[model samples]
Target: MSNAEMILELVRKNNGVVTAAEVTQAGISRGSLNHLVNSGLLEHASRDVYQLAEVWDNEMYQLQIRYKKGIFSGKTALFLNDLTDRTPIRFHMTFPLKYNIGVLKKQNVKCNRTKP
Candidate 1:
C-alpha cells in the first residue's frame, strides 16, 4: 500500500487520531498529509493532527480530538475513571500553569490544572 493509504489505515486503527510526528515515524511525508487533506480524504481536527472522515462517528475519535484541544476532563474523566454514567456534554482537561487555559474555558469545558 502507498504511504498515504498506510497512514490512513493507521488513523482508522487508532480511532482516527494521528499526529504528523506519527506519520513521519510511519515513513509518510508531511506533503502527503497535506495532499490527503486537500483531497478530502482526511481532515485537520487539531494542529498537527489528522483523522479520516469515515471514523468521524466514533466517540473515541471525538474524545481524542477534544483531548488534543485540551477541552476534555471533569465529568468526562468518568470515562477514564471507569465510572459508568451518562456522557458529559462538556469535557474537562487540565493544563500546566505555563499553558493558557483560555481555549478550553472558552469551549465551556472545565479547566482544573491546579487540582491533582
Candidate 2:
C-alpha cells in the first residue's frame, strides 16, 4: 500500500487517531503528515499527535498514545476501576522516571512520576 494509504489505515485502526512516530516507523514521511494537515484530512492534536478531523477522542486513549508509559493512576484509576462513585475532574497519569512530560503539560494533564 502507498504511504498515505498506510497512514490513513493506521488512523482508522486506532479509532481515528495516529502519532508521528507510528507514521515514521511505517516509512511515511513527515511531509505527508504536513500535507494531510494542510489538506484538512487530519488535525494536529498535540506535538506528534494527530486525529481524524472532527472525531470525538477519548482522552485516556489519546494520553496513552501520546505517552506510551503513562498509566491511569490515583483518582482516575479509581474511577476507571469503578471503585469511586465520583468522576475524576482531571486525568491522573504516572509515567516512568525521566519521561518528558512537555506534551502532557501542554494539554494540562495531571501527571506523576514513578520508577519503571
Best by lDDT, which number? Answer: 2
Which candidate number has the best TM-score?
Answer: 2
lDDT of each candidate versus the true structure: 0.72, 0.85
Please list the residue runs of candidate 1 whose C-alpha ends up more than 4 Å from where it truly belongs after superposition: 57-73, 79-84
lDDT tens digits by residue: candidate 2, 1-116:
87777888999998889889988888889888888899899998877889999788677777777677788899999999999899888889998889988767767579899887
lDDT score for candidate 2 against the true structure:
0.85
TM-score of each: 0.66, 0.81
Give the Cα-based TM-score of candidate 1 against the true structure. Answer: 0.66
Q: Count the backbone clashes (under 3 Å) in each candidate.
A: 3, 0
Show the lowest summed lDDT stretch of 10 residues, model 1: 57-66
Model 2, TM vs. native: 0.81
- Each model's Cα RMSD: 3.5, 2.2
Lowest summed lDDT across 10 adjacent residues in model 2 is found at 57-66
lDDT of 1 by residue, 4-102 (tens): 788888888887778888889987789999999999999887667787777555454454554653544677778767795687776667666566766
Candidate 2 off by > 4 Å: 100-107
